[model samples]
Target chain A: MSAELRRLLAEVAERESERFARTHPDDDVLLYERAVAPRRALRRTAQASGVAAVAASVALGFVAADAVVTDRRDATPAASPSGTSLTPTGTGWTELPEDSAADAWRVSGRPLDAFFVPEGPDEAVLVGADVTGDALTTCQVLDAFARFQMLADAAEAPLPEAPLSSQRLGGFHGLGDVGVYEAEFTRRAGAAAYLALMVEAAQMCRQAVGGAAVVNVEEDVAFSAVAGGGMRVDISRDGTDPWRLWVHVQQGRMLTVIAEPGGADEVAPVITSYFTAWDR
Target chain B: MSAWHGVLEELIRQRRSALVGYAYLLAGDRPLAEDLVHDAIIRTFSRARRLENVGAAEGYVRRAILTLFLNNRRSRSRALAKQHLLVVPDVAPPDDAAGDHDVVVCALNGLAPRQRACVVLRYFEDLSTAETAERLGLSEGSVKRYVHDAMVHMRGELGDIDPGPEPTPQSVVLVKGGAR
Candidate 1:
């Protein structure tokens, strides 16, 4: 064993551990009382009530999931089925229930229609759709590779050359524009590879905005799979330029929502609502 | 509600700092480390029967943290692109003095997840090779290989850090800098 390596490890151990311990300075008593005690009580209560408690908890969980979905749609304007013509069925394409939020943003006055396309033999389903508006003009489905190239250029991050099918679905509208952008590609590559590409694009955006008026940035901003693995990048300066840049991924699908901070509803729930239904 | 609370509270009182430090070592990010510790505490207390002592509970909780961390590493969410997970929101430029720390962490981050875990457990936590293998559910020889590989890589990245002492018959071999 190299003596120098041991010394470095020891230094890392001492420095990092000390910094963590010093900075955290959390209270043990509060944690026990606040976090541990409640769970303990719940366990006891559940044990005693047995079937009733179990039933109640299940109901509560369902209600929670429902509430989450509803809250997400609160800000989304209901889609007027009047404007959206029904696509003929049996093309392995499933029409998304008219979502007002999906219908709100437009490109060249055409109401962007959302749907699911099942995978076909010899090709993964091109769940071909994208949101292109003020912020997402660069994110067109056909230009995904160009978009990745652009992001790599801006962020100085290494990115694989966009897949042959790499189609850019949307681009950032501006500093404070708010809108929803969704894109799915049935690449020759697997879902995992697509997911990686989407995540890289989001990360590139996050890195590019480093010098901008980013007030708060929460990485790995969520824990639940339902929230769609995402990050919340809050950009505000002087309490005026408040906007949220949310980039979320599920399976191979990528959803990015840019919204004014004070908007009535969050984009997370809306994305979750659509994805949950798609999953079903 | 359960005897576990009494045991958990006592353990927290005694070992909260150590637990949090352990998590920080594994996670690198402070907030995630704290969250991991909190989650580990809840999980360890929630599932285990009332162990007789704090030492036993500490062991349970630490193992839970390691298991959770490793499992999380393998989980799909972290695969949010290869280096993307390592991307921090850069609000300000980092100071020059922090270079060594970042270098070490970057090197550490470069290791495969299991290798990183084995190295942390063996060197940072000062666990014996067998104990690290047991904790990770890997063979001792695997642990040695991981350590050896990790050390060799770190030396390349960091330039001649000490790899500590040679292995006895009972201990696993720790590769020195000049070996490979």
Candidate 2:
């Protein structure tokens, strides 16, 4: 780089450093926080708000373990996922994988490639590593159930008619060719709750206030159980749209977050946190 | 100080703007940048004591912030940007005064996210080839090349150094909203 060019670059960088906050608006802080939240996937526990708590306890079969981690924070050393240890790096946090953490309540560094809910929500947590450590995969699993319930409602359909198991992705423990069906099934697992939601959403989708909206986030995920990572399903829709739907069909873990209209912005980061939790 | 507190205070002192600005650009929005920076700082602090080899916490914080920034938009961030862009014109400009450098930013917002990030990081951040490499987790050579390529594209709207395949766009609006 030329001296002048370098200087130009420096000057601009200095100016932006000075003007960073001004260039973007405040609401975007929510957006960025939502985005960053996922990268860390830091564990959080916010109180479930309003219907979120009620609907969660109902037919949806989801627990509204909503945590308002108002402060963007890394999981405490004590709460860090099993086999994960914290090493103070710069300002915030970084988690290094341990050879092993307590096994009784554990989370794997190996990607959560497959999910099988035999009876579902046993005293055990399924995806605990992403939520609150080796604690209860409870909140995350419930969160998933809630989100899937929304999906089921949107398609105007019911849950899978058949039992699903013994699927692999790229010979790995994951979804295969039979994946799209599974994806469809999972997206709308709580049929009764979804159907009920559909009626309400349908009414809102047409109302003056648009009464209410259902929004969610999707990332690259193999909608197929047989395939591991081929295509991606990316769906990003929130308030700006009276209605928005995102379907992620890529070859990676699936992180779907659902929220009501007014609650969309607030819930977005939580959803992203699920993803970030996994990535870290 | 507890390692956590030490890291947080040190990083807050070192990279308040660099980290925040990098995050803001990655998010393509302002408030988001603060959130991202704040979160990244906290995470960086957690790992602060362990960051042995690095010189300034800024180096580590910048990298974490960039990683967080790049990873934020697998799909959703872009859609939000498009929606926001379409509406900004409808909403009045937040400020009336546009500085010379502001013109450069205006031109930048016109480019794609990665392109804009490349431009901003290269020009605005003035990151060294090595330092930029560290921040983006890219190779120094890659940083050198991206910077060159971004500048070439920028020169057209920035005031003509070379005209390449990418046509000269009529307007490039650099996002200029911030706390200050």
Query: Against the hidden reference, what TM-scores do the models get?
Result: 0.41, 0.34
- Which candidate has the highest lDDT of all? 1
What does each candidate score in C-alpha RMSD? 18.4, 22.9
List TM-score (chain A only) for every prediction. 0.35, 0.20
For model 2, the superposed segments whose C-alpha errors exceed 4 Å read A1-280, B24-28, B48-55, B73-97, B113-145, B160-180
DockQ for each of the predicted structures, in order?
A: 0.17, 0.08
Instruction: Estimate candidate 2's RMSD in Å.
Output: 22.9
| lDDT (tens digit, per residue) of candidate 1 on A1-280 | 4545545566665565565445445545544444443333323322333343223223223222434433232323433222222222332222333353343233222323343111110111111112112112111211232122232221212222223322322221222223455545353122223333433333433343333333354544443435335455554433343445565544335565555545313445444443443321
Q: Candidate 1 falls in which docking quality class?
A: incorrect
DockQ of 2: 0.08
Q: How many residue-pair clashes does candidate 2 contain?
A: 73
Candidate 2, residue B62: Cα displacement in angstroms equals 0.6
Give me the candidate number with maximum DockQ.
1
In model 1, which runs have C-alpha deviations exceeding 4 angstroms? A1-7, A26-28, A41-280, B1-7, B73-99, B162-180
Tens digits of per-residue lDDT, candidate 2, A94-115, equal 1222232331112222222122
> Residue B167 lDDT in model 1?
35
